[model samples]
Target: YEPSEDALQVEVDTKTIPHTEFLTYVFTDLSSTGATVALDWAKKQIPFKIEFDVSAIVLADIRQKLQGEAGFQRQNWEQAATFAMNNGGDLQEALGWINNAIEGQFFSSKTFNNMAVKAQILQKLGQKDKVLAMVPEMAGMANTNEMNNLGYMLVNMGENDLALKYFKINAKNNPANANVFDSLGEAYKIMGDRKNAIKNLKKSLSLNPPAGVKANSERLLAELGVVI
Candidate 1:
C-alpha cells in the first residue's frame, strides 16, 4: 500500500493473517507511523477490516510500548502525543506523554512539535497559566520560528497578554534574531501599545530583518504614522 502521494509502496503478505486476526497487525504496524495516520487510513480505506478500538490504543500505552527503542523513542513519544491530541483522546494523558518525550535525551529534534502540542493541550485543558509558565521552557526547547508561530497563535486566540509573554521570552532567548522582535512588535500592536510596538518594530528593522519581516515592520510603522 502506498500511503503518500509518491510512488513508494509497501507490500504486506496477507497470508499469515488468520480470519480473527484480520487487519489488526496491519493497523498496529501503521500506528507505529502515527495513530492519526492509521485511523485516517482505516476510516477511509479499510473501514470494517480493522476491529480495534481507538481508546484502547492509549497514549500512555503507546509510550510504554515505545520504551528502549534505541534512538527513536523521543520521536515516537512526540507522535503519540500528537495523535492523542488530534484524535480526541485524553488531553491530560497526552500532556504527560509529551512531557516524557520532551524530557527524553533526544528531545532537541522533536522540541518544536513537543512544545506546540503541549501548549495546545494545556490550552484545551483550561490550563492557560501553565502555558504562560512554559515560556522559558519553550524558549529553550523551540526554535525562533516555532516560538514566533506559537506567540502569533496566542494572538489569534485573543490571548494578547499571553502572546506578549511568549514573544518576550523568544526575544530574550534570541536577542540577535529580527523575527522575534518583529513578532513582539506585532503582539504589542495587537494589544494596543503603540509605544512598545513602535519600539520593537524599530529594533527589528535595525537588526536587518529578512525582506518579509522588513516589509511588515515598515508597514506597521507606516500604519502607526511613524516615519522610519
Candidate 2:
C-alpha cells in the first residue's frame, strides 16, 4: 500500500528515536518484534510521540545491522529490504537498505552517511550527465535529506553548475544547515571560483561541521593555499 505523506512522515519520525529505548518499547508495549511490529506501532500511534519513537527504532536497527559483521550485515540488510518492501515500507526505506548493503566494512555510525557520500563521488566519476538529468525532477518531490543526497550526487558527477543550483536551493530552504554551505563551496571550487569557495567554506566552518567534513574542508583549503 502506498502510504500517504502523513504516514511517511510518521515513519520518518519514528525512525529517529534512540534505538535501545525504542526497541524496549516495541518489545514491551507493542508485544512484538521485527519491522512489522515497529510498523504496526507506527500505524496505531498518533502522529506525535509514537512516530518519533518508531523512527528512532528504525534508525537504530539500521545502525546496528550496519555495524555488525560484513556477511551478517549484508544478510540482514537483504532481509530488512525484503521485509520493508513486502510489508508496505516506502521507497525511501528500500533504497536506504540497498545503500546500506553497498556501504561495506560493517555498519558503524557513519555507514549511511559515508554511503551517500561515496555514491555521490562515484556518480561524479562515471555518471555526471545522468545525474544532472535526474536531479531536477527529484528535487521537490524527494525528502529533504534525499534531495541533499542528490545535491551530493551532482557535485560528484562534476556537474558543479547544477550541483550549486541544488545546494543554493537547499541552503535557502535550510539556512541552519552548515553542510549545505560546505557542499556549495565544493561546487564552486570545482568551477574554479575560489572566492566564492572560500566564502562558503568559511560559512561551513562557522557552522561547526562534523569532524570528518571539517577535516576535509580544512584539507581542501590547505591545498588551495587559503590558509584557514
Candidate 3:
C-alpha cells in the first residue's frame, strides 16, 4: 500500500514473522485505517516497533518513564505548579517544587509566569500580605525601560511627585544608565525644578546618551533658562 503523507518509511518484512504461528503479517503504510484492517483481519494489533536489538522489558521501562506522571513533573514543573495552585492543592509543596525547579538544573522559573504561580499559591494559603510582599520582587524585576516609561506616564497624568518617585528609584537602581538620568531630568523639568533638572540633564549629556537624547536635554535646559 502507498505510504501516507506523515510516513517516514514504510516496509513489510515477512522474514521477521514466525512460520509456525499461522500468522501472515501484512504491514501496510496505514494509520487509523491500517489499524482497523489489522483488527479486522488479525484480531490484534501488530505494534510498530523498530528496535529489534533491545529487550521488551527495557522498552517497557523506558515507555513507563516517558509516559508516566513522574516524567510530566520532571519536565513540566511550571505546568504542574500552576495546576496545583489552581486546584487548591498543597500549595507549600507546589511552592517547594517551583523553587527547586528554578534553582535546579531545569529552567528559569524565576520569571513572571512562575512567580505568578507562587503568588497564586500564597493567595491560596491565606497569606495575602506575603502575596502583596511580592511587589518588591516584581518591582526589582521590572526592566529599565518599564520603570522609565512608567515614570513618564505618571508625568503625563500630572502626577509629578509620583513620577519623581519612580524616576528616583530608577536612578538609584540604575545609576549608570544614561537614559535613566535623562528621564529623571525630564520629570524634574516638568515639576519646575529647574536646578535639579539642569543637574540631571547635564549628567545625562555628560554620560553620552542616545543620539537625540543629548539634544533633547540641551533644548529642555535652554527652555528652562539655562545658558548652556
Which candidate leads the pack in TM-score? 1
Q: lDDT for every model?
A: 0.74, 0.60, 0.66
Alpha carbon lDDT of residue 149, candidate 3? 61
lDDT, candidate 3, 112-192, per-residue tens = 456656766776787767755664565566688866765664565455786699899999888888889988998888888
In candidate 3, position 193 carries an lDDT of 88
Per-residue lDDT for 1-228 in model 1, tens only? Answer: 456777634433323222342333234434423432122232233322323566556654775776656226677777777888887788887887788778745553446667777888898898888886776666666677887887886786677887798899889888889989988998888888999999999999999899999999999999888998
Candidate 1 runs further than 4 Å off: 1-72, 103-113, 139-150, 153-159, 165-176, 222-228
Compute the lDDT of residue 9 as modeled in candidate 2: 52
TM-score of model 2 vs. true structure: 0.43
lDDT of 3: 0.66
Candidate 2 lDDT tens digits, 136-222:
556755555766677776665556677778878877887767777777777778889999888888888889889977887787777
Ranking by lDDT: 1, 3, 2
Return whichever of 2 and 3 wins on TM-score: 2
Better of 1 and 3 by lDDT: 1
Taking all chains together, the TM-score of candidate 1 against the true structure is 0.53
- Cα lDDT for residue 100, candidate 3: 51
